[model samples]
Target: MDRSFEIQCPPFDLELSRWDTVFPHWGRSFPPSHARRIHCFSLGRNADKESLVGHLHVAFHHTVQRVPFLAGSIVPSLEGGNHQRKVVPQGVARLDIRDLSHKLSFDRLAEEGFSQHLLAEVLCSTEDNTPHVCLFEANFIDRGLLLVVSISHIVADGRGVTEMIKIFAQNLCKAQAGLIGYPLETTQEVYRSDRRRIVTGNGVPGPVEAHPALTSAAAGTHSRLADVGTCCRTYRIGADALVALKKAASSAANNSWISTNDAISAFIWRSIMVARHRAGFLDAGNEVHVAQPVDCRALLGLEEPYFGNAIYMTQGSLPFADLAGAATGLSAAARIIRAQIRTATAERFRDVVGCSERAEQEPHTRMKIADDVLAGGIILTSHFKFGLHQVDFGPAFEGRHVKALRFPVRGTMVGAVIVLPRLPDGSCEFMITEQGRTVECLVDDVFCRFTAETKTAKSVLPPSPTSPSRNGQAEFVFPESTSVKESTALNMTTLQAPHTGTIKIIEMNRPKAKNAISLQMLRQLHDEVERIHGENTTGGTRVLILASALDDVFCAGADLKQRSVMSDAQVEEFLALLRETTCKLAQLPIPTIAAVAGAALGGGLELALCCHLRVFSSTAVVGLPETKLGIIPGAGGTYRLPRIVGISHARDVILTGRRVEAQEAFAMGLCNRLVSHDSSGTERGRALQAAIELATDICGGAPLAVRAATGALSLASPAGEEAAYASLLHTTDRLEGLSSFGEKRAAVFVGE
Candidate 1:
């Protein structure tokens, strides 16, 4: 009955396994203590609370007798110092029950998308006054019951916990069957708790190769890992999608055999990498490493029921381009993952154990490992094989009424992807934890595809300005419009002229902020640009005129107030997004015109540089003033400005951080047109009118011809020129043009 016991030596002290020793040294990286695994089980409408709690306690007591370490506390051994720790057996682990039938319900949680706040209310408290006690807390709600278990990772891996749960459930079932105190028979001979057997190697260590987890921290791959504000999102992949993915992967691998794990893991990895690239967290030139925790019980000759941390980190690497590529990326990534898995043999695990033990002895190397393991490129942990779905409490209640399981995490490392247990139908749930913005971007990336299938899933995406079509493969669809002021959406508005086929105008609004580019504004702009890029193949738009609604200023550049509050990671992400948006704008298939009526400084000037033509009013001033703020123009200004004007002019504009007047800018070939305030309209109005006129003129030309001409110029090669000419040879527009010339009449040509 005594729950508290004095710490003793000898029999009470259990030696720590090598796997446990390498798990971040209890309380450094793992808050409060070494890694804690939290699992929640939703028992639907099971109202036998009194009986269940009694049974759970009885079952836990009996299970603890078999696995005594479950009720123990891990501490540094008195003789071995902190480097060699051991678990001291305490007493019984407690089970607490709470009735919250009045405040919460399963339906309410589902309605609220199972938010973290609500989850925290149900899950066992992260704060444990008795840190030594690994306990279970059951929260009872209306029409449901929630059971949460928290266990230290040092004492057990997922399989170990699963085994414990299995025994506990089996005993509960036995109690329900009138065998109240009878302990379920376990394979005691096969069960081994000795840490030495986990790593069968000589004490003498060999040379350790640099691990990705250790090296990535020093290389600064995830420098912002700690600074980033993190959040978790859940998604479920249906059985059909898994089947399709496996088939597609196999075909892509030239009919080579592939496993379901490889296919799904590869698919998720590729999707995330692509999302990261689109979110500006990574670039195509960078290479990303994925570390998967492989269960080493089988490889190390340990039985399935063996307790302790018998896990090893297996790593696979891929270039961003390969993972994010449109073709064969999924299969390539899958092959890489499979290769890594195949290489995780017994010999390799022994080598890893040797390397790990040797590295941990060195303070510098140990710290590096602890820091980098969480901050590395990615860590994929799959719990599908843990038999979570097979957990049965008893036949007395709805034994199969396990609705959902949640891990109420207080914190997360960078790029952590946890594959949760599979549903009865083979569908798998995923928990992705990352920076707030990265999660937002990931939501957009994943939801933008197969949205129809995930209609029941919670959506964390902000309301899109334009609804993308979910027919088959999802695509952004821009609604056709006539000449009218487009309704204000997120940041900007779109307007299309009646006479100019598809010549659209993007008006930057936010007069109060002086059209400053905030993160939201940048995301919206990027989304619009991407939509236009997709529309290009269908000849949806002919010309794009970038203008501002504010009369006195085109844009004041990045919102300094917003930037001041942003973290370094956020700033970097924003800058990357701005840079990518500008690059996309510059590479538009159609002609692009920027109407700068007033001050266009720093990123504002960079935005103008992306346009093919810059039309500035006489009252306008342009310059890259980023140098004044102790920063360079990050949004392609430093590179594009020199490409636009000569290097001398670009240097004069950038180095001094001095604004150039419209006349000076035009003289230096910075602006294509400098319009004076004529009788037409005000300074800003006149600038927009001039840009519109230019766009109208461009729209008059054959769309195909103009597109071909721009493509040829962009390519700037003999092959490009020939291809451009050949592309027009068979077009209906060419025939129309010839007929118009011969007949001396204007040709009414379609885009084709």
Candidate 2:
């Protein structure tokens, strides 16, 4: 039983160092921690664990056309000789981690592999362990998906190196029994038992006598991905600098019990409160959350080493109005944070999470998190003591390589408060983002009050004290970085399908007559029909999609009320164009599809019959309803209606002039597909996207094959009347279709 024989591939076992040798730039972009974990995985494709590490270079597909700051996905590593590493539409690499973690629900893992997008993002942010790591969010959209990777490099290097990531996935998958994994990096029993760590003022000592395993890095380097920024200025007060700064921070908060974190959170909160007040959102609720990281390592006991980070957050939420009151200062805000910390026990965390399942008949009022929920908020987090600064990369430089990597990530609407600790002094550093100047003033007040005596406080955005600033200015405007490049990728789409050159969309813009066509409308449509017939690359025209604006209703059907205003010659001209347009559309070289989103009655229903297939939405109402005005359908309706929905049903509806709903129209064969429309234009846009995607698939085939299929679908009445079709039988479209279809699957059409 040679287990080595079970190795997936030669590339799968390339070992971490092999990547540094094979791909020249692998070592440059990624830190050793990241490179070591993924280098063993397959690089060219998803062969094994090695590729998972190597796959970090794959870029993301972004549907958000507006964001200029972020790359949609991945920090690509491939350069130089590897042409295959270029961005191409293909399959993705997979991961073996979380092979059924109860927390991450990825049962769909068998269907698609662990998204290369997800694992690589975790790797990128896990690089450093000092900076605080923000939460990552992923959004799924109609076009594609948007993934956000936010983390503080203070936790780990830009590359998060974990034993779970470094080992080959296939090797672990084959290891089987728990005996082989005796020293599991994380265990459920240990995590469950240590869920409640103490909140002592002083940090506890390492696990020595009580337990061995718990003390061995239960908390490892911080591992999260975010683009981080820091704003810090050091201040000195004579010799005892540390003691004095702590005194000012605590004194501003006016609480002997409050730690430096509470004071910082309070300061950041007050700044935001003033900013919100000036932004004209004075009446709206402006609640901000200040989140502090909580480590449960000591609870796991002295035996644990800081192996992999296991933590949660303590959040304090305060309203902006509370800070805006003239008497309320940093001390008042700090008191609130102190109260929140007092209430924030492990039991409270469990209770809040448990409340949902244990509610007493409360109505579930949660919006869908996918498209709507989790959209807007203000969140603050700190990773001050995550020990990420200790990351050593075997002397790459005279100093450390990675630093904090985090940025204020925007949601539908979200602001941020970020904090990091300066070394030696241990005082906190902060970065804040909000919308207004009132908040900026409060932030200035907090800073001036804390470091007032002798510390030099500078700002990337300095307040204009000497300059004549606006008196009690209500708004604070941050300069926006404007650099938007329009994408030319859209124009590259070529429209060359069998039905492309044939389909013409006609919009009647007459507002007065409820958009009903009079003599002029008939003439315009008639001329366009002729142009379509002349230019159609197919031997004849195929489809015509007609629409109108009642400029409110689709059409009121006919202008019969104004018929007496016209002479007989004028009447003849109008009837001729209507008949010509209808006949031309029906005699198209292939099948046509009519889409009705509103009313289709009388002349409208008569015109609709020109198409071979009709699709109507639930909003559409269809009928002949013309004879009520004591006249029959004028356009080729009398004959074409019978040819379409059958003579029996046609006579019943046309004679009685009864209107039918969209679903009824489908049942009677007057409509082919039934679609529902939302106010969002989602259903309609999806149809267009589907159409274009289908067109893209068809365009991949030879253009001639589609043209010949158009020939076969033509509505020639009899065998003797197929002379034009006979000539096309000898064309290149026929030869390509015969050759391609004979090979099975699809016929590659080449329009010759």
Candidate 3:
């Protein structure tokens, strides 16, 4: 049996908070995206269907009077798009009640766990185009009642939904007890006024620019919604197991403090990675990043009753090797996750608001994560702290209240994890929705092992004799050490300065790892270039050629393995050094050329772009693929690439993190020359030889005249360059060029 009706709303109009304004735009691409909360309520013995329906209608109507926004229609901001969208009372709320007593039993639902039959009845499709809150109730004969509430994410977030439910339940219980004139803790006037103050004071914070990884992941998930079916499964962790898990996490972290949420989240994240790896979705070099939506109401100093979208999406990442290493690896992963979460402090929220205000002047395309491109990661949304079970309908059903809360599984939400409230037995449930065999593997392999190992305190006690246990921590024997002969670090880079030539060469010599730049190599290169500048007293080196001594690659990028082990402060220092070195190279007196032989990525590409010209081999590929790893090109790529290649082109390359081959790079003006392999069947060093030949031809010109012309051309386009270089006339390089031109007899360049 099925019946549908509309609950009349109380007349009112409520202005939205600044936070509410961003959701409509954030979800513009995915119109069907909304908050679908399925709350299972145990009504003890079956109540009369007609009586229950009447009671619900009365409760909903009264609740709407107290919180009119629930029954309001979301209207576009009438302030001409200057503020957040507003909500006006529509005088009606859609309510649907369905009886599944004949078709399915409630016990069957519990045994099977979230049946598609019930799911199909509750889930909303984008085609429905319903903008208002939808209430769906499925009554099970002699079993219980299932309440499914679907609210447009734009109308309210999880907190708002919780608030509405609490009020509705309170009103229903009061009406059931024949009470009259119940006192309300909060009214529409008070809520609206408070929201107005917060909005006016802080202004609406805009969405952050989407990283390429996020956009790629989102697109992939959206497109593959059909091919990869979506399913949700709930994993329950008992209270004792939670304690043991927290202990394990803290032990792995060397006694570091680990919250229950962090410990559980870390365990789940690692388990998912292991599952993905077993399913062949992950590789050794691939990194997994996790995005967690953090509630920022407390950080923003908002009161408890305020209902809006007050959240920040924070992220953390780790290499597969490190995360899947030893048992203690969970602690290391937890540390990273905790650090990222700590960034969502009050100060950071204020800064985000400031950025949003500044962004209003220049709008940009918002970014989103693509599902297929996420490199095996998860996005977790937690309602564990929302006290969902505490939402009592009345004393009549006190013993038999909410047993479980499950969110609707959307196909586009693959790899999404929902952390629900603890059950009556003090066990928490995790509802993970994903595609492919990932969830199956997670349940069959990881969760089973974890449950077996933590079944009892004695089960995991004493640890393994072979591995041993140390002070609450497990110790496993590491692999045998592989020893290699030490090599001189200074030889990683070599400088070839001829006694008398107009060209100098700097060659990268770390061939074993494709000449990936290490901190030591970078320092050596910087020192050698500074030394060359000091020694060139006559400014005679008209061209500096940079090439790789390796066979197949110019430079793979920075030494990520080395960087992975560094602290945050150390990483900052390393990036600063790299940026400074590249800036100096770009500002050198003589023109520089980068001879690219193979792959140039991340810092390698940034370094190559800093040079005045780049010559690529036929097999070479170049790109700034940092966003794939959840980071941006930090060493001047964001700024320099836009200047070199127009903003649109740079945005496309940087945002997509796609590699450009030699032909494409040259066509896009990313490379000055594209040299083919030698016909003599030798490709090694072919690009370098061509670059040297190009430098030699350039050296044939008057040295002082070349230097002056290069400097003048650099200052010709940008404004204020003239004033910045007004002292160029007093330089001996400028005067010598004038004198040499007048003499016209190939005037000998002097050691001025």
Candidate 4:
């Protein structure tokens, strides 16, 4: 009853253009998370099978000639260097044909639609690891033919696929018209790899180093990995309803225009919230977060037809209670979503791209959201602007155009909504994936009425005023505690041994240049840690917290301005000393934490990486940007970062010098915790307080046990767990822990 056959054509070679290399980084960082989009087109009444097959073969050959990359295979860079791997278009593109004419009528195929299992089999039939395009056709007896094209995400994004399909359709039309020669003007010009288009300044410093495969966290986060019990339903929203929703949102806010996407996103978000509340899945106090991916080709000044992964995923958060109440809730939610969309300016897009580039350089850094945010978040992707309706196959075809395009459900998350292009009747289709109860509640009369009805009120609210500034320039305000005082006890560095020396706080004191580490400062830090280790022989100091006294900067890395005066030999000596000091800090018997408030770059980040854990303020950014200066991260960064995050992520960070913000750092496991700044206090103050509290909590644990655990976990990289287990077995703290557990009280033990 099940029938499908794949024909692998002869292989062809294609030399990659400059643009091909630019895409390898995207493929390396983000593997295919979503299944290949299968668009079903009705080919009217079927003609003779032999004639149809012959026509299709000639059209496909012409398509390959016009778009050579479709038959190419993605080749990754093998040697470690700055040059990205090339896409060698030297492979066969498979054509799959499935005949359901005997088992089912054409009407039946149209009525029942393609099952998930059948579509998945056709798209995922390829067993190779490389990326190549494929085409599938399902034939029915009475109605027509169903055509499905599968494109790898690694090769192209949605926009790219759309363009390729358009070209193929055009080629088919030309052949059907009996034209001997197709116009060259109809062919698309392949763009070159122009770093100037994506990034500013000197562009990519050198050839890109090949990164490893993506980690599960980074690659699987955006995928549709939902449960088996889940169902996919398509809801139609008429143009009139969309207009009414937008009008309601616009009227609710003073002179604020709401886009159609914003209005629909808000409506869907509110519906989900209501459904969750009705099903007892809503948390009253927590905020509901929505993430949307925005294509940034226009923002980056690239042409609309540019082919690549040029999208940034951004998020917005709103109070759950706000979206669960009256009709006004929908309007308010729309405003919030609109504001989030508006914030994605050119500068923000550049920042995200820069971060991606840096992440690509590091062999181990992964880009992910915080655990709390990912659990209940809603991800909405709108493809209405893709112009899917305009894809014309040929005059011989039945419908001659795509009726609808559907994306497969690949995630097990709670909310995922995809908005397709408008139908011929001006009705938009929304493919929603959620729990059965949530879907049932969303389709009920109550929520449906809210979306269908229009608000009659014309009352316009007043626009919020902007912050006042003198002469169109904002005034600078300094933190209350900007004054720096000296401590003579530790002359080399500023050491605060509060809580009877149980928690040692070492603050980098250079404020003039944002705490840049000079050679003398490095030496002083080394000696100070050595002294602290020697003094804590009796387990008096259980935790060490590294911080910066400056209000905005934790540490800016090596003192480049100072290093300009130093001889070449002095620079080498300083680097050696910096490496040794960081190693000593990492090997410390007690637990260590880095409390970062602002920028931590190069050696600054290297020092933080040496610590057992890191706590970052909302404003903190960490990266190893030595590659920008035509150098590599020499001080243990190349080695330690991979062990921390993973080799793939490490390559992204190291090679591209991407700056990692606090939230992303926490998600990637680069920072153990993230601390948001308080409105009433400076960021540095909040971060320091958090660090002190964390150190205090660590101090409460049995000091000997903490030391033993730290030593064992540190041995995981070099000697593996055997050394760690041997070390743990020799420690008497294990017996103490067991005895305390039996005694049903906190463990209090001596160094013995």
Number of the predicted model whose lDDT against the real structure is largest: 1
lDDT of 3 at 66: 77
Best by TM-score: 1
* Tens digits of lDDT, candidate 3, 390-417: 7778654525367567765553356677
TM-score of each: 0.63, 0.31, 0.55, 0.50
Query: Compared with the true structure, what per-residue lDDT tens digits does model 2 show for residues 527-629?
Result: 6656666764543333345544332345556566446655687578667777877888776554445556577778777767886666566677878876887
Give the alpha-carbon lDDT of every model: 0.67, 0.39, 0.63, 0.61
What is the C-alpha local distance difference test score of candidate 1?
0.67
C-alpha lDDT of residue 145 in model 3: 65
Residue 157 error for model 3, in Å?
1.2
- Worst 10-residue stretch by lDDT in candidate 1? 478-487
Model 3 off-target regions past 4 Å? Answer: 24-32, 44-46, 78-84, 114-118, 121-128, 134-142, 180-191, 194-196, 199-227, 251-254, 354-368, 371-374, 395-398, 451-752
Q: Where is model 4 more than 4 Å wrong at Cα?
A: 1-35, 79-86, 103-106, 109-130, 133-142, 180-229, 360-375, 409-414, 448-752
Which candidate do you rate higher for TM-score, 2 or 4? 4
lDDT of 4 at 624: 96
Task: For model 2, give the 10-residue run with minimal summed lDDT.
Answer: 481-490
Write model 1 residue lDDT over 1-752, tens digit each, in one string.
11222211112345666656664342144322433444334454645666666666567666665666666766665653355656776454556667777878766775565555576765546564355536666667776666666667667766677788778778778777768653433223322356766565445545444333333123332444566666666766666656666665664436667788887788777766665655566656777677777788787787667767766666788776676555567678888888778777777667656665655455344323233333226677788777677788676456443556666667556567777778777777777776655554444343334322122423432222223244543222212220011122232434453323577788776655687887756877888889889884444777888888888888889989768868898788888888889999999988899999988988888889999899999999888888889988888888889988989998898899998999999999999988976676789888988998998778777888888998898888999999999999999889999999999998777777
lDDT of 4 by residue, 1-752 (tens): 23343333333433332233433344332334223566655555646554555555556666665655566666666633353454554565655555655554434434444443334443444332435555545443444555566665545566777777787778777777776232322234452344335443223322222111112244554344422246556555555556555665564446778888787788777766766554445666777777676776677687656555655556777777676555466678788788777766666655544434444454433323222223355767788777778778776666777655666554324466777776665556666766654554454313443332111102211111122346663222211121111121112223333323367788887654567886556765888788777875454667888988877788889888768756687688888888889989988978999989899999889989999989899999999999999889877999999989999889989899999888888888898878865697888888888888887777665565567668877775656555655665655566777888999987765554
